[model samples]
Target: MNPEDWIAHDPDPVTAAELAALDPGERAARFARPLTFGTAGLRGPVRGGPDSMNLAVVVRATWAVSRVLTERGLGGSTVVVGRDARHGSAQFAVAAAEVFAAQGFSVISWEHPVPTPVVAFAVRRTGAAAGVQITASHNPRTDNGYKVYFDGGLQIVSPTDREIEAAITTAPPADEIRRRPVHPDDDTLVDAYVARAATVRRGRHGHPRVALTAMHGVGGELALRALQAAGFDDVHTVASQFAPDPDFPTVAFPNPEEPGAADALLRLADEIGADIAIALDPDADRCAVGIPAAGGWRMLSGDETGWLLGDYILSTLDGADAATSVVASSVVSSQLLATIAADYGARHVVTLTGFKWLARADAELTGCSLVYAYEEAIGHCVDPAAVRDKDGISAAVLACDLVAHVAAQGISITDALDRLALRHGVHTTAALSRRVADPGEAAAMMDRLRSNPPAELAGFPVTATADGDAVFLTGGDQQTTVRVVVRPSGTEPKVKCYTEVGQAVGADLDDARRRAAAIELQLLASAQTW
Candidate 1:
């Protein structure tokens, strides 16, 4: 180990030593590429280089953030940090806190593991300049992440992410990044958030009973606490996977949207004869609901759940001046929300595909009260007053409340959705993904799609084509979108392509399902080239 290697190679002492210790192949794998930070923040496989999120990289990131905050007049501002049950999460959280405290900034670290949303809420609720959460979200166990949220209580946006990346690039070295020991804040931010969520919207009648699953994450306690506070006592918490375990022992993947993901919770719902099973992702930022339908438990897609929530909220407006305005992402199923908004004389706005944008907009906007906002990825923001970001706890309670209302009418969420579709026409959403090994390959795929744009897809004219990552299409009164959103996932080897298609509703359920299936095939055909 030559000292000159530190000067010629990596400047960071910790990273340099770690790299030197590794063999040739190992070092090449670790230093394959630099960490790419974007709207999602810096995330990578837990490995050996500055590119990956090792201990040294984590320290560098925190120190860089400390420098940025200080330069931005938020130098002495306090920060609240939290983590989920992902591997190395607690250690990362502690490292961040120590770095911030060493920089003379007050730190309030979580006493125990908590959800990502809770950390976002604490950041804003406590008037901190920024917050960090250590979790890989729904990614595979081999992955982990560092997600940053701003004062506005949303994930750090574009330019901000770039600036933070620059800060990290300019840091002296990993070991030089000052870090001081700090203890967790005695304060209870999640408790206060739970208390506030309880008051989202009191039903004049009664709250619905619900079966809840944390997907082996950290939302069970908060969900239970909020449900009880909201006057719903019949909430049944799933016994298995209820406790927070970073390993996620039960499920292959911790996402609620994945196939067979909610099987355990569905079984529990059947056992309890519960009307619905509510499942949240590991970070508690995304949610899914399953209702007892035909012979088995049927789970609703993210768009379906958002539409149900939107319809319920909009229906309650009662054509008053205080009509609810629904907000959804540009890529989400806008047909349902648009129809409801038009019929009820409410407003609807479309933003980029991220809850951070939705939550920040909800917090900043004043004229219209945001009743509902959701993305097709299962991220939802119900009440900005209680939480500027997504809240699975609030979504759980809202799910119960909506289920109770529909059950009173002797129908399930599926039936209600059918009715809505029959009245305003049905719409279906779908996605197509192309995975590649390297970021360069992902970029090349996008370039290929851009160079050879499809004029028509599934016999429908391409409405618009985005050369960058996504493509959009529409046909007749009914519209279908085939987006080729290409990006190297923050925590995985594969790049993702999100595609969607929609069709008008008919009198029969089978017909609607058939039409949706055909449209899905067409969308898939078009995505083949992309």
Candidate 2:
């Protein structure tokens, strides 16, 4: 469709004006291709064209989602809609709710901005057929997104995502889609989510001081509430970052994983003499942890946090049926969790990267439950039964519980990690990425790597190679094991390489850690060349 035709169909005058103001070349680019709905749902800049996120795009996408659900025999069922504090989120969320209501489905909408996990929890709690959240997560301020979760509160994957895209391709123009103005639902769901999140905490061990930052996102208040509800009263917050600000004025990027994103939180932790610090992404779906180091306050790598949480959660499940309980991690994550699960006699499954896949780790096993799942990108599902997706709020609560439990035992978080390293070798991990012009270039890079597998990476012979959603290379000597996984990032135009070097604990733990870190840097450097 041309720009003029798209402007005609645009429901929001703001976006229509935006389209009208675009130059001819820019207008042509906007209409050259429509946004593709993939596993992550629709995400792009907020603009007035089929290629961007706007009222028209949201309506059409919701209509397509409705059609797909109806075809799956979920017609007229309940659908939950929520949004974050990003630009255009409220309007886009309203448009989604209106479309769902017009399609004869019962729509439950939130009047206020909410974290992404609230919608996921609502879907399961209300037994809704689907849920839609308008959020870009940790993306830049200029971007927005539409995330969809099916009946089980898990994000749509594979065939469902493809089906939704196909339906969207045939959707009528935005103006032609029927819509009914709908009011937001009550706060009962949010309240219930908080209650369930609080329940994740075990018995109170100690009240360790904690410093938290929401990263100018929507998770701050709720995280505080959950923590307090779980008997964590000695909590301090980064005052400047507690409130939601769509512009993310403080951090260059909203992601806590990015460099210096948690500086404010760490600063607050130091000022308050906090025992631990936590940072949640914009949508509060990802959680990062910081602890006092020998030099200064340093954030724990995602893998380190994963190891701690996994050990803590598994430790509490003393007499449970380990045969039916499963803990999972992505292929790109460290394999120490598997060893930890083995120690507890629990099963561990490795799935492809993405919470969409990790959420359904126990789907193929009958009479089994996914007790926990995490990825190396600070996304952890500590309470899978409550919320199938990565939830920063609940993870924060659980992390606090872990801290309190360790404090009661006269051990610091660092000491707990050292204990784990002693039990299960020192596992060092790093990630390397190469940005490309577009997704095609990323695919081409992966193809080249797959076609001509490198014989050696950082002087370690590539003893084995496997191809799946990503290429996995395994090599090392008898004393150490080096593994790398390379794949195109689903949400960005970059080829990501995850590297790990594992060595058994010997007489000297510090030496093993230093050697492993050095090898990890080499592996990262070699992977960068590809």
Candidate 3:
């Protein structure tokens, strides 16, 4: 990745010129190597370097995808390319389509901004060879990404990701790749997605007041369509964030899980006295929910929402055969979902993090059905058959449906959660993330934790501690007290700690939550000191 070599091969003049202008130190640092592509695909600052995500990088990545497709006997097959409303997303998406077409593959381009899950849906519905979404999810405005999905509508996995990276190593210059832009009528795919999303609705209440925000991304319009189609007519979107704006004007960050990100949506819900509130990330693959609390509204954590939705879905299958139900959650997520599934005579499966692992849980657990899979990061796969990925739109519909159903019975979501606490244990989860200037700092922090494994946390004896890429620590019995998982973020330059604590339903929920927060802060505080 020498500067001159990259300059010679790069097709985009802007990036080439940028590389040419950089000093030796800058050039070496920027072009020392290509950005690594893991389960999350390629992501970095949207600039003009081999380490950046620009037109040249897109072309090379698309070329790699094309080669892998061809090697797998999918030479002339179609690839679905979608994008969000980021700065270079549309251009990158079209460039990807051209590269696919040039490689003798058919191109299915969105031709406009769409959510990441739309790419997954289009791939599954069209039987395309693969799908590429030009987005960065909830990353900063200066950043962008390329997320790849495969034939079965799952993100590209281990051996395949490595293969694509290998092809990228020797990709031809961008100009040498063929280019024929093919645009399908966008209305067809959109209509199909809307229809499929509406099918997840199972409610007895009509038009319960709802409030929503897209966090200045592409999910607003599509989510509106799906919600209205699913009989939620009284939906009110936060006006300021309804349109797509790459700068994310209203909040410090666009992710709903962040502190101030969902403030505008909750404010609107309060102003309108809406029954429920919804927040979708920049690209809308994940969802976060809010419900009416004691005095105002409180946004539910990802695990709380995931458990509520999983329980709701399972309750609908009250009189089914043994093949009726299967639900899943990530290993780091709360185990209450498993308890609920078992109570309902359903099977529960736990997989590694990411929807790519959770999406195809049905294959891993045969016989039972695949009803739901969720993670603690606001990701839920409610309708796994339709979109084999975490789908914010469908999850929102299910959330609203749950609200309306409960409202029909004179109970709010708060009451339902209380009942769940009484039925199952009061399981609460918290997360702590420490940002560092360099990723190496994350490794160092994890090393420190592994070296001095805590025998106890928050006055509770540690029952177990395991280490690999991360350090997993448990305090007291797993059913009570705490579970701590300290790991580097799959993406981004940060180390994250996830903690879930529980107190038996007859005990105090506040006590469990306070102790969990204390332990989480203690771990993160220790990391800061290190």
Candidate 4:
């Protein structure tokens, strides 16, 4: 569509003015292609045009979602709509709720910002036909998104996402779409979610001194409430970051996985002599942990936290039927969770690199339940039964419980990790992400790597290769095994390569760790070339 046509259809005068101000070339670029909807839903910059996340695009997307659900015999069914504290989030969420209500669906809308997982949890609790959350998660402040979840609380997968996109293509113009004002629901659901989240904690040890940061997202108040409900009274929060601020002035990026993102939390932890530190990303769906190291303090890598939490959760499941309980992780994550699950007599499965896939792990195995699921990007689904998505709030509560439990056992989190290493070998993991100018470049890089597979990386010969949306290479000698996964990121314009090296612990655990770290660095160096 041309700029004139887009402006005519745009519901918001601001975006329409933005379209009017753009030059012909810039306008053409903005309308060159519509935003592609996938399993993760629509994500883009908050600007004018069909390709951006303006009010018009949101209305059309909601109309399409309503159509898809209606076609599945869910026309008047309940739908939960929520938003985060990002720019344009409130408007988009309201627009979405109106569209759903106009389509004859019962809409449960929130007046205030809520975490992404809270929306997911509400879908299951209310038996809603679907849920939509207007959030870009940890993305930059300029970006926004629309996330969709199906009846079971799991994110919409392959065919469903494709169907929604197709429906979106057939949607009417924004001005033509019907709308109905929706009254915001009460906080009963929020209270219910907090209660359910608190239940994830096992027998409580004395409250450990915990430090937390919300990373300027919407998780702070609810996270604190959940922890307090679980009997964690010694929790301290970074006041500067506890409030939801869309600008994210404190960090270069809103994501907790980025360097220096958790610096303030760590500083507070050190000042208070905290036993554990937690950082939740902008939307509070992903979590990063900080701990005391040989130096002042260091944030645990996603894999390290994954291993610790996985071990703790499995350890507490003393009498679960081994064959009926399952734990899952993304293919790109470290395989240490598999070892931990096996030790506890539970089954482990690997899915594609997203909670959407991990959430459905239990469905593939007959009579099995997903006890835990995590990805290496600091995303953890500690209570899949309650919320079938990565939930930083519940994960934080459980992490605190893990700290208290370990303290009661007369050991540190580091000691628990070392014990796991001794039993399962020193498994080290690292990732290399290379940014490109555009998505095409990222795809081209993946294609090039796939077409010309390297024979070896970091002195380890490539013994096997598996090809799909990503490429997997396995190689090593008898003393060690190396695995590398290279793929284009689903949400960003970059190609990511994940490497893991496993070595059996010898009499000197330090020596084993040193050897593994060296190999991991070499592998990362090699991956940089690709």
Each model's lDDT comes to: 0.73, 0.90, 0.85, 0.90
Q: What TM-score does each of the candidates earn?
A: 0.90, 0.97, 0.96, 0.98
Kindly report which residue stretches of model 1 are placed more than 4 angstroms away from their true locations once superposed. Answer: 1-18, 204-207, 318-326, 332-335, 362-366, 476-491, 506-509
| 1-530 per-residue lDDT for model 2 (tens digits) | 56787798888889999889989998898888788865467888888888888899899999999999999999999999999999999888988999999999999998899999999999998899999999989888999999999957999987899899899888988999999999888898998999999999976888889999999999998999889898888989988889999999999999999998999899899999998899999999999999987889999989999999988888878656776789999999999999999999888999988899899999998888999999999999999998999999999999988888888999888899999999999999988879899777887898888888898877889854655658999989988999999988877667889999999889999999999988888888888777
| Model 3: CA > 4 A from native | 319-324, 477-479, 507-530
Top-TM-score candidate index: 4
On TM-score, the stronger of 1 and 4 is 4
**303 Cα displacement, candidate 2 (Å):** 0.9
Task: Estimate, for each residue in 69-152, the C-alpha lDDT of model 4 and write its tens digit.
Answer: 989999999999999999999999999999999999999989999999999999989899999999999878999999999957
Whole-model lDDT, model 1: 0.73
Clashes of each: 4, 0, 0, 0
lDDT of 1 by residue, 321-374 (tens): 435454555443455676677777877777665665676544455766667788
Identify the runs in model 4 with alpha carbons over 4 angstroms from their true place: 1-3, 464-466
Q: What are the per-model C-alpha RMSD values against the true structure?
A: 3.2, 1.4, 1.9, 1.2
* Winner by TM-score between candidate 4 and candidate 2: 4
